[model samples]
Target: MLDVAINHAVVIDTEKSVEKKINIGIKDGKVVLLTTDTLIATRVIEAKNLIASPGFIDVHGHVDGYAYSGELSACQGITTTVGGNCGLSPVDIADFFARQMRDGFVINQAELIGHSFSLRQAVGIADPYRQASPEEFAAMEQLTRTALQAGACGVSFGLDYSPGASFVEITALANVCAEFNRVMPIHTRLFTQNDLYSLFEVLAVAKRTGVRLLISHFVYQYGTGIMEEALQIIDQAIENGIDVKIDSGMYTDWTTFIGTATFDEQTIADNEMRFSDMVVASGKYLGKRLDRELYLKMRKHYPNESVICFMGNKAEIYTALKKSYAMPSTDIGTYKKGEGHPQIAGSFPKYFKEMVKERGDLSLIEAVTKATLLPAKTFGFAHKGVIKVGSDADITLFDFEHLKDNADFPDRGKPDAKPTGIEYVLVNGTLAVDQGGFTGEKAGRIIRV
Candidate 1:
């Protein structure tokens, strides 16, 4: 008998533009069969009104094995999450993976070796305004190589967070990733509002070093009404044979810590961002918009607390996601239930609610493909992100008609609220969430490069 079987479900074939009613059988954490006839299994689910698709893979998240964050991710139907994004990750990649293996986790995790913050700190370079010395560059290269050998998926750079990071440091790190046949995910520098040049700089890296580049949060970088032009530049780069791709969150606004260099007075003035446009999402000032006094208090006292900046254009968010090359991601991190940006819990559901159900910008099959196969192909995760025989049995069953995101920003309600209409989520053929509630099972594994 099969380990698990989902019956009478509408299977979304992401590779093909079709959805057919079928039964899927799983055993040994792999898909065993797909057919219209009844299947015998040790555990069977009757999914009469649900759409069964390959499990969602979040390509850009900061959930580095925090249990609360993983619970939020699993609730959104994400079976695998690529964490260690945006210049912050645990320095000991092997030890982090080992801890996950030992303690068990709710979702599969693949991590990137972060530059700017993690690596610089590892080598005792505390000043974000000064370039690394030649000696420091050599040391960082050695650490990167070690992490790659320990199964890091790639190298990530949050250039805006470390303005002093020079071209030499970035190119050197890119060379190491190239040698390992790994991709580089860049959170590009935003010199000002409408900074298309930042996007160009990352594209130039791909052009110069032949490294596969995944631009993090395209909308946040170019959402000031320049998405079309930014996408054209990416298209031109792709025509030139440089492998460039991007991932974007569903919303226009982006969140980060209050103490980062990005929130410095000079950086804020340079970007033309007003303190009034920022809201404190965590800690003592939760749900309050930042005034000069509160901003100073948070900056000095609660430096690590998160703040959401009400910037970027909504139109640009939809426009950037319209590109077939863009995959949906949640910039999720560890936060309390009622504190954090709604994007942490609502991104994927909002993607479907807006793109497929309401506006019709993308077909159901196309949206699923972007969320599944596209990221898997980009990152070279071999066994995940497709619904095929022998593929890993990570799947999501949801009701298309009734699905909606309940989480809103901190001022509204709980950002970690579980979405509605996600009926069941299976990770490694084990029920992680059943009938829209968590099953208290941690069936996830650490996926190495």
Candidate 2:
């Protein structure tokens, strides 16, 4: 007998561009079979008129074991999230995983050993405007090796947040990642408006160390109308046999800390960004636009607050996602019920609705593959991204016609509105969200690389 059976469902197999009605049998958290065979199960879910695809994997996120954020991710049909992105993460990967396993989470999480912020702070590299000394670099390398051995999936760098990082620091870290065969997810350095040199810096590291590189949030990095040129660079690198890929969210604007190097007055002037173009995304000034006075006040009082910078072209978002090597990401973080970016609650649903159902740029299968198999393959997770027999029993059921992202920016409306038409979400053979409602069960696990 199987633990659960999802009967007569329209299963979307991401490996191939096909959809068929199949009955999936699940036992011990794995798919046991997929057939018309009369299978008996402890509990059976009748899934008619619903499209069942592998649960979405967010390639870039910052959940970092935050409970509310994990719930938001699960509610958005994301069964797996790659966290500790953009230079922020818990210092001890092993201890973080142990605690998650002990308390039980709401979705599968794979962590990366973060640079720029977490590792730098751990090694006592306090200055963000100066390169680390040789001794500090050595200490960082040791800590990085320890985290890699403890099962961190990759090394993450937010170079823009740490402009002080030199070639030696980046190359040394990349060398460690390459030696361990781990991915290097880089949020490249941006020193000026429309700067491609920052992207090239990461490419240079990939060229030097031969590390597998996953560019973090392509739209945020190059969505300033240079997406086509950036894609060409990535294509040329791949042609030269370099493994380079990117993940992007559906939004053009991106959010980050107000006190980071990226938000410094000099950076704002160099990037040609105006205070009016920035909006307070979290904390006391939640929906207010930025000004000199407000910026100074927020920078001092709310240093850790998040602000959304409106700096990218909308057309570039589609341009990036249309690439074969690009995967959809959320870049989600922990936020309170009514405070956060809309992408946290609406990215995957918006990807399907806009790219597939509205614009017809991608077929449903292609979009699903980008959201599912592409990420799974990138992370080397064998059993999590496909709806085939013997795969993990993580699945999402939603209506193609009715699925739409209702969440918008704070000035527009609520940022945490639950999307429409996500019918069911399951994690490890257990219902996390049922019929558009949370089930109050945390069945997620920490996935060690």
Off by over 4 Å in 2: 37-40
- Specify the poorest-scoring 10-residue window by lDDT in model 1: 409-418
Kindly give the number of clashing pairs for every candidate: 0, 0
What is candidate 1's lDDT per residue for 1-449, written digit by digit as tens? 89999999999987776899989999998998998898889999999999998999999999899988888888889999999898899888999999999999888999999998999999999989889999999999999999999999999999989999988789999999988989899999988877889888888777778888999988888888788888999999888898988999988888999999999999899988988888888887888999999989999999999999998889888788878888999999788778899988999998999989999999999999899989998888987888879899999999999999998878768777778988899999998889999887899999899
Estimate TM-scores for all models.
0.98, 0.98
Tens digit of per-residue lDDT, candidate 2, span 100-215: 99999889999999999999999898888888989988988998999999989999999988889998899999999999999999999987757888878888899999999999
For model 1 the TM-score comes to 0.98
